[model samples]
Every structure is written in structure tokens, then in C-alpha cells.
Target chain A: MIELVYDVHHQVTFRWLIALYFYFTGMSAGSFVISTLAYGFGLEKFKPAGKVGVVMATLLLFIAPIMLLLQVGWPIRSVWNHFTYLNFSSPMTYGAFLLMMYPINCLIYGYFMFKGDMKRTKIFGMIGIPLAITVHGYTGFILAFGKARAFWNTALMPFLFLVSAIVSGLGMMIIILLIRDRFFTREKKINTELIYTLATMLGWMIVFDLALVFCDISVLSIAHAEAKEMTHLLLHGELSPLFLGIENLLGKVVPMVLVLTPKFRSITTITIASVLVVIGILFMRFVVVYGGQVLPIV
Target chain B: MAKTRYAFVIDLRRCIGCNSCSVACKSENSVHLGVWMSWVKVIQKGEFPNVSRSFLPLLCNNCEDPICVTVCPVNANRIEENGIISTDPHRCVACRYCMAACPYEVRYVHPIKKFVEKCNWCLHRVKVGLLPACVEACPAEARIFGDMNDPKSDVSKLLAKHPVQVIKPEIGTEPHVFYINLDNDAIEKKRKVDVL
Candidate 1:
């Protein structure tokens, strides 16, 4: 057996890694689901998020792998390892399985959406929506099952991921709609009513997520073991800036401010807010991946 | 069944922090830029007046329960009974799950090859009955490579004579590298051993 440490050492910051992966995957799945609200199920208002959802999904899908690649030291050998070593118990193995499944589903869904034939392909959308949720939810389950990190080892992670995905997906949709309204077409212009409806759901989820985060931190603080040390890293250590500044401020607070403010309801204001929220979500992922590893009980 | 188990033990007390082991592994492995097959960690611990540091040479621990092995979707990582964790470059898809799974952060991907690569414990040299390039090159004689199962091995003899500890025993990875006279405060604080 190789001698290993039971403490802090330099490892890639995983503080927000889990969050980031889930965010991207959530975005991909969430966008697909939101788009289906219009394209698949014939909900006209949901059409706003659908057009831009495909593009955002593609962007997020590509970026998610980059996060995985950077975490692993070798990007090339990682490809080979996936094919050669198939351990059913490993979350990564399962993640790979879902990763493969996701794109195919997207492709099928995309064909109908792009071909302007979603109305005829009711079965695909009906099948695709649940599949999207499954793919994204499973990502959360993979992390939740790992008892090593307290923050991730929760039954709520899948719900958290799913909620965050919806928020992000909707935020992206609104921004895309606004952009389309400005540049492309006003046919899908989302009225304040729909935007508020999406924002209200996002508000609840964000508050719930923060509550879980607070509870997780408190529990870790009380336990005061390796997990506690990691929690400390998240709360007050190198990661504090992200945990305190961006994730809370940009991701939650600013977006909330945008949605709630009477004066802040302008298109430009909301667009900027959406961009910040996206950035905040990315920061959350960084903290989660890097934070968990910071104080490992080696 | 044929077993290819590989293992390593580092004598922390004797480690001069010269980084000769890291240097040797680098040249031998021809590790690409911005990446390493083996590396060193310098940890410092304690208050200003009592602060002390130690140099830790790190490589693939070639663990019995290798985290990298389980996380790889492709079977890129394997252990020889001699105890070396070997990576098949051709098989690696660069997914990096192993990097996340590994607590050590020792494994690095070659920039050019994009294959998961780390210290192989100089398997090619060991095959010819030569010590690992790093072991042979250590100026302080801080490392020993041998079969722990064999009581006659030098590593086993050393373990019997001295008290030692691994870096992160809590993770239960069962690392092969052993540290002699490791700083208690450093271990408690879980800080890197390198002070400088």
C-alpha cells in the first residue's frame, strides 16, 4: 500500500467541481426540458427558452467535459481508461454512461426541434424530457452517494442540481429571448408574467440551496473532522472569497435583486444579471470541487 | 496467478529536500512540460518561532486499493503484483476521473501525449534488476523499493526497525511511501511537509 497523508495538500480545488458539473449537466437537461414546454408540448410562452436552449445546451455540454478533463491530470489517457477499465461501482463509469446517453437523446430531440417537426414528434419530446431529467439527476446521485464529502453526501443534491438547472436554464432562456427580441425575432418575446413565474421558482430553489449549504456547514463545523476542515476551507479559507463573494452575491443575490427590483426590470439590467448568475454558478462548481479536496483527511 | 505488485517507501528523516529523486524521475521519464511523473512537496508547520519544514518526494503510491483504478471508465490503470500502478497511454481518453479520484494529485497528464502518466517506479529498470532511477539518484537515500510481503526485503526490515507514517492514512488508500520522523504538528494540521 502506498503511504498517503490524512491532511491538506495541493490537489485541484474541487470545492465547486460537483456543483459545476451538475450546473452544466443541469443546464443541458434543463434547457432541453424548458424548450419542450413549447416545441414539444405546444406551450407558446415556453418557446422563448427553447430556441436558445439548444445553443446553450451545446455550450454547456462541451464545457462540462473540460471541467472533468482539468481535474484529471491526463486528458488523453482519460479517454482510453474509460473504454478499458469498466468498473460498474464507479460514479465516473456511470457518468460516462450517462454522458453518452445524453447526446444521443439531444440529437434525436434536436432533429425534431430544428427540423420544425416537434409537433409531429410528440413521442420523442415526451420520452426526451424524462430522459433529460434522469441524465442530470443521476449526476447528482453519483456525488450524493460518496460519503467522503459532507456537502455532497446528501439526498438533496439531485434536487439541488435539478433546481439549479431549471433556474439557469430559464435564466438563459430569458436572456436569449431578450437577445432575440433585440436582434433576431420578437415572435418569442417573453412577457414579464412568464419571466416572473420562472424567477419565482428560481427564488425558492436558491433560498433552499442556501439553506442546505448552511446546514451542511453547521454540521461539518460540529463534527470537526476532515469534513469540517473542508467546510472551513469553504467558509473561511482560500475558497471564502468565492463562497462569500461570487456564489452568494452574483449567483443568488444579484439575480434576486434583478427579479425583485421595480427599477431593475429593464432588459439590459436582467441580461447583465443573467450573465452574472451564470458566472456565479461556475464559481460554485470551482469551490465545490476544489474545496472538498483542500482539507482531505488523507 | 502471476502478480506484478510494485511499492515504494520514503524515509522522511533522511530526506534532504534536495529534490534529486524528482529530478531523476523527470529525466528518466522524459515527462512533458507542465506535467510530472514524480514530484516533491515541501511542507511547513507550526508557529513562527517553532516552524519547521520537510521535503516530501511524491509519485504514484501504486496503492493496493488504487482510487484511480476504480474511477476510470476505461481500464487504463492496473497494478502489478510487484506493486506499480501502470497507465496504458493508448487506452486513456483523458477524462481525468482518476485525477479527481486520487487524493495525492501525483498523477499528471503529458501535455503532448494527453495520456494519463505518472511515476512507473522505473519498471523497465527494475526488470533488469536495477533500482528505480529516483531511488538510485536520491542523494539522501530517502527511498527504498521492495516487496513488503517478503520479510527479507530491505523495506520490510526498515519498517520493523523504525516508526513511520504515510501522508494521508485516513483516506484508507494505503499508500506505499512511508515517512520516518514525520512532524506531528504538520500531520495534525494536515499541511504540506514542504516549508520552503
Candidate 2:
């Protein structure tokens, strides 16, 4: 007998959803890391990226929901349900609370980053540092909390997400520097020393993220039939090419080789390496968001 | 304890996957054309001879410990005395933290209003002592509405007798929506898995 399935309606689009997911994930990562540098590591030298990071975080604060709207296909009415509380245990409920906290923390961080006054910056920094990490870490928890998707059901994901944000944020800052140095400040010499330092850090981060990817995949391979089904879909399913080519080769191996190698030791080489790493990380985010949905357990 | 507690119960067995509930929800709430206030997800599972499809109408589960409420810095979302979670458009700074925090991915920010919103369970209807539009419009008599606290209520009786399931039980949202005959793979079927 032919099995026929029915539904109320199909309101999702893979293409747009995937695109938006990558964009927001990148923004979240990029924004979080920049803020981290200002707060967590106490990199007082890189104050500019810190302030800019807060702005990026706020922009992403709004952009993420827009991405959700695209997923829901209804921007206006669907949003109201968030306010319509039936139960308190829901993650959506917590997410709403976190959403509110993130921007406030970011704005306060932004205030300190730009505020020339030392006392105010100190006070805001006191609050902004941990807030930045928690805010970014919460994004990872949101994904992991969904136990239905094995791809996201990992504790390491939050750290992975947190570091990936740092890698991208540094890359973005470097790209901005390259542009500014190349066109805006043609007289000033390129900061090769800093590039080498960040490039090395980025190289290591990419390695760590890839290593986690390996462990996650290997563990999932033997976990259960559901994970196996998901693995197969990711490897051979709709997102396979992206997972293999963009996320693996471009995002992982190629960039790692470029950064860690001896031949590409110059500042120009490091900049190019960072650029590739940024592209790779963006592709990885796409895979993470879209991959979680394509292989469905049932 | 407290007398004021509000919630919803969905009868999955009777739902026919018709968009009437969603449509009724949109019109009654004056939601925009492209934005949906409530949604119903249809998941098909199993293969060939063993294939069995299930219909799960998704809405805000409106959990007991709302992740969205606590994260809001502006206090846009508030749990009323009656158990309805709502956002004050005036207070909402249009931050979408609630959207990211939600495991169900139901919340979205309005394009024009620039505030977060989701299924309010028709607060307007609830205030008037009437059922939500979705409950009133169901052709299959699948949707039920009543107070969980009121022992004499039909919903209370149904919950007492039937073994019901909530979506993503492992997350511990303590959702109030009760599903009957919901297959184990219902939420799994809708989930998409990714690698690399």
C-alpha cells in the first residue's frame, strides 16, 4: 500500500532559511568575540573593535528574529505568541529573557568601550565581560537544548561557538584593517606583527573546532540509528557538498594549511589566510544550522 | 496554590491538518499577512508498508518556566496572573533574544512594529470567557479548552484518563499542551540533522 501523508501547509524554505541562519550565526559569533576581547582578555589596546562589536551584537539581536520570521513565513502574528505565556518551563521563555539581557549587556559594554571617561568604562566593564560570554554561550545552549537534533546535542558546542565567534571577529577586524591600511591609510605600514599573532591564534582555534567536529561525528556514528541516519544525510544528503567542500576543505583544511605553513609567513599571507578562515567559518555556520534540519530523525 | 493559572490543551487525534486553526488565529488576532501567530506542523514518518504519518499542530507550548520571559532585559514579556505570556509593544525594544532562546523556534519580531510576539492563545477570547479562535474553528472537534485547575472541566477529565505526551519532554519545559496518539518520532520527523 502506498502511504500518503497530509499536512496543514508547508511554510518553510531551505534556501532562504539556510542563508539567513549562516548570516545570523556569523553575526552572533563575530559580535561576541569582539566584545570578549574588550572584556574577557582585557585587550585594552583593541578598544575600537569592542565598541563596534556591541553595535554588531545589537544589529544581530534584531536580525536573528528576522531570520526566524523567514523560517515561520509570518513575521507579524507569529511574534505575538512569544508574549502569550502558557507555561514557564519553556526554553522559548528563557530565550526571550536572554534576548532582553543580551542587548542591555551589549549596550552597556558599548557605552564603556566608547566612553572616554575611565570610571564609567570600569563600571560597565565590570558587568559587560561575563555578560558577553554568557550571552554568546546561551546561543549554543539554545541549540543544544533541542534534544531532538543530535547534531546540536553536545556540551562542547557552546565553547566551539564561543571560539568560532572570536576567530571570525578577529578575521573581520583584520579585513577592516587591510581595507583601511590599503585605501584609507596608505602611508601607514601594515601591522604584520599583530597579524602573525592573531593568525596563529586563529589557526589553533580552527584546529580545535575541527577536532571537536571529528569527535562529535565519531561519537554520533556509534550512538544509535537516529544519529546514523543523521550522519548519512549530512555526508550524502542535501548539504553534503557544502559540508565536504565549503565547511571541510575551505573552512578547515585549506585555511589551516595556509596559516600554519612556513611559506605564507608574511603579513599579506596572514591576511589572506585569515580571510579564507572567515569564509570557512561562515560556511561551517551554514552547515550547522541547515544540517540540523535536513536529516530529521523520523 | 495561587488561583490564577491559564493554559491550553490540543487534541492531536482529532486534528485534520486543516489550516483553519492557523487562519482563525491570524484573523482574530489581526496578525499581518506574512506573519503567523500560531502554526501547525505536519510530520510524516516510517517507510513504505510500515509508514505512518502524524499531524502535530505546533503553537507556543507556553511552558511553566519560560526561557523567553527571564531573558528579556526590558521586561517586554510578562506572565499575567491568568498565565498568559504577553509582550508590551511599548516596552519591547525589538530585541529578538526571546526568539533565539526559544527551543521551539516559534517567536519572531514584527517587521513594522519591531516587537517580539508569539501565540497568545487568543487573550481577547480568553478575557471574554470564550475559546481561542483555533479551538472554536476546528472542524474535527479536535481542539479542547478549559482550566487545568478546575477538576470538573472537560480538559481536566481528559488529562486524568488519557496518557498524553508533550513535545521535547527532555527539555523539561513542562508544556501544558497534551497530545494523544502522538508517535515517538513526531518531533524527530520535523528535525533536520547536519554534519561538518
Candidate 3:
């Protein structure tokens, strides 16, 4: 009945650069938690991954903010301006502090662990846990605080982002640890027991993540006019290839089944699932950020 | 003395889908080559023989509770003394958070300068005792702009008599831009070829 003849198309504001930023940070956060398992929580079997986890966590966190810097207009000026003009109420303001503090905490945590200073490592590892959570968690708040985008405006955003961070982190770690074990380790044998344990954790985290995604889409489908269109766009329209095909079916569901099903759980399957998960999480970030503004608001 | 609170009123009855307002706004702001600060969305309603063109002139509402001001990372966005949600051009880091947050989709990144910019109701002109270009250029006087705090202002007069509406009032940004006989269909339909 109604046909749009001449309306300025709303451009996708937060593009793939932001998505890559989210992906890196998510993995960094998840890796930080894995590192904390042995040092902070006394999970001895995960001890081998503890140092590599912290190293990956720190390195990825460092890489994450570069995307933010590049996406901004004036990179050098913004670095200074972001610090000086602190809008504390803004979700992005939370990120400024978290990004700076979390990496320093990781370096400190990793340093103590390397020096055989268990007590100090434990303390910093514990401190870094919350910092890692918030660093990535704040990105979700940025989207959630956007307040207009149908799916991004949900209360479930932060939780959904947090769990996905953990999922991708675990997946990245599995691949990294396996690579490290195969080539870098003194023994040529892969650590099956350790890999299986991490897979179990990845399996469960993905389950939690899937549940959150399900809940989010279900609510959005029935919420408002915009929300309805959002569901339609992602579930069926232009966003379907990215959202339904890549993000859910291939990225999440496939990986979830591979990791969770007992018969399907193997070194090769786990590695494939881990690879899929890391890629999937990246798409999720893309889907969330790009999809937020892809469909015009007014 | 009453504070200046500027509001806009679009009299749709008088609008003839002319691009006068849209062209004036771009020239007034010198908005970069491919971006727009204000533009009119045209929708053709009903089947061929019974078709009628409905226009939705779009611009920043500069809401009473502007989300852009709340969500700007560098505090680049703020409400002016005149109640216009103004952007500090120098401070804007091109973090398009405001662009994403604004339901109106009025904000855009300047192609060359790279800062986020939008229609500030031709703020410079308004401050210098001139009407916003769009208002002055409208042949039918459809685009009405004036201080809401002043009882004698045209906006105040029209608002007092007309049951005006905003684009998405339910979201509660409390838009200062009021429209007479605004078409919801004009707001709902998507552009035929989405560039994104």
C-alpha cells in the first residue's frame, strides 16, 4: 500500500571495524578467564593454558582498541579528547577506563605468574577477571545504551555479549593450545584430556549463549513495530545470509552441536568447532553492529 | 525573562513535496558532498490509479531528552541555552554513537571532515536573528520554526491550535519537531534500494 520513493537511506553507522574490535575483545576476555582458572580458582588441570591464555588475552586486548581508534575521525586527537572529555554516563566512557586498566592488570598477572609469584599472580589474576568482563561487557552496554536500535536496546545485550565472549575465548584457546602442543611443546603428542575439558566448558557456555540468543529473538519478534522488522530483516530478509545462515546455523548451532554431542566430540571435530566458533563470534558482532542501523529507523 | 526553547512545526497540508527545505538546509550547512542534514522522504501510497505522494520531511528533532547528548563519548553533544542539541565540532571524534542512537537517523558523518554532523535547525542563523534556511526557503511556509517559550512566536501559536505529532513519540525523546497530519506510512516503508 505504501511505497518509499525518496528517503535518505540510513547508513550502517557502526561497521565491521567495530565488529572486529568486539571480536578481539571478546576473545581477549574469554582467554583472561581461562588463564584465571588455575591461578585464581585453583583448577590445576588447566595450568598449562594459564600463561598462554594471559598472553593471548593481553595481546588481543591491545589489538582491540586500534579498531576503535581507526573508526574515529581524528585518531590522535580522540585519544587525548576521550581521556579529557569524560562523559561518565556514556557506555563508551566505561570502555576507556576498562581498556586501559584491564591490559595493565593482565601484564601484571602474567608477570607474577612467570616469576613464580603465585600469591601476587593470584591477586592480579582475580582483579583482571572483573576488568576483562567489563572491558568486553561495556561494548554490549554501548549497543544497549544506543536505546533506539530494536535488538541492541535489549537488557539481554550485556549478558549475550558476555557469554559469547566466553564462548569465542574458549574456542580460540583450544585452537591456540592445540597448535602450541603440536609444534611448540617438548612432546609431539596433543593434550586430549585438557582439550576435552576445555571443550566441555565451551559446550556449556555456547548452550547458555544459544539460550540468550533464543530469548532475545523471541522477545524482539513480538515487541514493537521496529522490533518486528528487525526480526524479519535478520531472520528472513537481507540480513538472513549473515544472521541465520552464518551467525546462528553455522556459527553457533553447528559449533554447539559439535562440541556438545558426545559421539561427535573429537580432536578434529573440536578443532573445527573451535574454528567455527571464533569465526561465528566475529559475525555475531558484525550482525549486531551492522544490523542495528542497516534497517532504517525513520 | 523566559529561556529560549526552539521548536519546529511542519504544516503537511501546505507542503507540496518540494525539495526547497532539503536544498536550503544542505547549502546553509555546506553539508559535505554525499551527506544530508535535512531531507524529505517521499512515499507513494495506494495502487497506480489511486496513488498519492506522501512526504515526510526529515531532520533532527533536537529532542528535549536528546539521546545523542546522553550517549556522546567525548561530551561533544550538548543542549544549548536555546534548547538546540548542538554538537561541539572540534570535540566530536566521529564516534557515530549518536548516529546509531538517534531514532530519527538524521545524523551523518561528514565525508571530508569526518565528524558526525546533523541539522541543528540552522543554529548559526537562528542565533543571528534569521530564520533557519529551510523555513525561509519554503514557498508555502510549511516549515515553521520559532521559540516555544515565547507565547507570541509562530510555533507557539500553531502548537496551541493544532494537534501536532512527532515521528516516534512513543520512544519518549519528546521531539521538539511537531508535524500536522503526519503520515505513519511515510515513516514505516523502506527505501527501495537500501545502500547499506
Candidate of highest lDDT: 3
How far off is residue B39 in model 3, in Å? 1.2
Lowest summed lDDT window (length 10), candidate 3 chain B: B187-196
lDDT of 1 by residue, A139-193 (tens): 7766564444555656776776676677677667666666676567646554666
What TM-score would chain A of each candidate receive against the reference chain A? 0.79, 0.80, 0.97
- What TM-score does chain B alone reach in each candidate, compared with the true chain B? 0.87, 0.90, 0.95
Second chain of candidate 1: TM-score?
Answer: 0.87
Q: Model 1 chain B, poorest ten-residue lDDT window?
A: B187-196
Model 1 regions more than 4 Å off: A1-24, A38-97, A113-120, A134-160, A181-190, A220-226, A257-276, A289-298, B1-6, B32-36, B39-53, B138-142, B186-196
Candidate 3 accuracy as TM-score:
0.97
DockQ, Cα level, model 1: 0.20
What DockQ, between 0 and 1, does each candidate earn? 0.20, 0.13, 0.66
For candidate 2, give the docking quality class from DockQ: incorrect
Which 10-residue span in candidate 2 chain B carries the lowest summed lDDT?
B187-196
List runs of model 3 lying over 4 Å from the truth.
Answer: B189-196
Tens-place lDDT digits, model 2, residues A49-69: 555566766677667756656
Candidate 1 residue-wise lDDT, B1-196, digit = tens: 3343455778887887777877787788886666766766566655668766766666777777777776666777877657777888767766555665675667655676666677778888988889999999988788898877777788878888988888777767788887777664443434322211
Ranking by lDDT: 3, 1, 2
**Candidate 3 local distance difference test against the native:** 0.89
**Can you give the lDDT of residue B177 in candidate 2?**
73
